[model samples]
Target: MAGQGSGGNVIAAICNIFFPGLGQLVQGRILAALIFAILFFGGAALWFLIVPAIIAGIVYIWAIIDAAKYKGP
Candidate 1:
């Protein structure tokens, strides 16, 4: 069930690697995409601080994993 070929979810996750919410947008999860986009870009905007940068990195990675693992209609 998981890790089945290069399916849409896989593609989504790959897209997320480049931009945190891109995968969600591709998957048609508009709200989730918006949240991810806001957090990612908001944090990125304040990435001058070390803490914000680290947090943004963590959120980015989480978004990637979430996109890869999401299972739903």
Candidate 2:
């Protein structure tokens, strides 16, 4: 709410740590939340494959960083 590095962003980042895209949802970014959730969870669901698992891990980290650095539009 107060741009990147704000307390809200920190909290959002922490939320994303627990659940990918949850931070976006908390920030009222429905589309972003859906996109990240789908990407991360979908990839996670296919974790039997090495590539998908790696992709999901990357997505999970990216989601945290995205939430932390997001500046509201």
Candidate 3:
């Protein structure tokens, strides 16, 4: 269980890193994913600073938590 959760978290983190909210989508959090995607991408387009990257990192952490708690397909 721990391994599975950790793996899911890693995947979610990676997905979120590449495409914000993608990890949430994978975990069945479609609305949240869409929102994050819009905000993340929009921010990236508007501001190319370290802030977006930091936000991505924070989202990735959230993804890890979500992944750890996920129990569905």
The digit string of per-residue lDDT tens for model 1 on 1-73 reads 2443448789999999988999988888899998888888888889888787788888899889888888865
- lDDT (Cα, tens digit) per residue for candidate 2, span 13-72: 999999999999999999999999999999999999989889999999999999999999
Q: For residue 18, what is the lDDT in candidate 1?
A: 88
CA deviation > 4 Å runs, candidate 2: none
Ranking by TM-score: 2, 1, 3
Candidate 3 Cα misplacement greater than 4 A, ranges: 1-4, 48-73
List the pairs of residues colliding in candidate 2: none
TM-score of each: 0.85, 0.96, 0.57
lDDT of each: 0.84, 0.95, 0.66
* Higher-TM-score candidate of 2 and 3: 2
Worst 10 residues of 2 by lDDT: 49-58
Model 3 lowest lDDT segment of ten: 1-10
Please identify model 1 stretches exceeding 4 Å from their true place: 1-6
Clashing pairs in 3: none
Best by TM-score: 2
How much does each candidate deviate from the true structure in C-alpha RMSD?
2.5, 0.6, 4.1
lDDT of 3 by residue, 1-73 (tens): 2445567656875777666788778666798788777766665564568787677656556654655566654
True-structure lDDT of candidate 2: 0.95
